[model samples]
Target: MRVQGTPDELVTILRETVVSLVRRDGPDLSARQLGVFLTVYLGPGPHTVRGLAASLNVSKPAITRGLDRLGEFDLVQRKIDPADRRSVLAQRTKRGAALLREISAAMADAATPQENATAPTNSQLARSV
Candidate 1:
């Protein structure tokens, strides 16, 4: 993200990111779901179910279940793999990309000390965390 800061500053940034997400009513993604989603979006993908299972140290069915939730949110799409017809490929979606942008924006907002009354400061965010 090119976000430069010390460990404590980064901690403050992360804390603020959480508060910003909650304050802005962002999607509440489970760690597993977020993992799958981020892997698809951030990493090189044409990603297969088997690959995801291995990479995440999770079961194929668990990945499938997480994909179901992500698909419901329009965050991911499952397609029959062209090269390996037997496999399924997990692909990203526009909505998912938009959500990432939303998160990044919130994090950026968080980095700048909150001036508004509704948004919490880093200390308040730390307490919540």
Candidate 2:
């Protein structure tokens, strides 16, 4: 469906969807973890920790921490870059793909109107944002 709203409005809807989702079903993630996860899952891969850090403007240690959490959830895997034994690559997992699909579906549901979507209030989303 066509998303009919200002960008901020659309963002509000999406923020609410995410809050409801986490409250109802969790694999609750911090902002940092979510950012790293999205970058790896959405961006071109054979993703390296250094690349993620530079792209996200975070430190290698921070990326490693987030990756560790994602790894605990089986949402990402760190593999030795076969071409370079000294470096490791971050790869998406089946579970991570499933989570992304779930998020897409949630965004769709949030965008739909007259659907009785259950989520936090706009104020809550605004505060969080």
**TM-score of every model versus the real structure:** 0.76, 0.81
What does candidate 1's lDDT look like per residue over 42-107, in tens digits? Answer: 888778988999989999999999999999989999999989899999998999999889878877
lDDT of each: 0.83, 0.86
Q: For model 2, give the 10-residue run with minimal summed lDDT.
A: 114-123
Cα lDDT of model 2 overall? 0.86
Pairs with steric clashes in candidate 1: none
Task: Give the alpha carbon lDDT tens digit for every residue of 9-59 in model 2.
Answer: 677777767876697665888889989999998998879999999999999
TM-score of 2: 0.81
Relative to the true structure, candidate 1 reaches a TM of 0.76
Winning candidate number (TM-score): 2
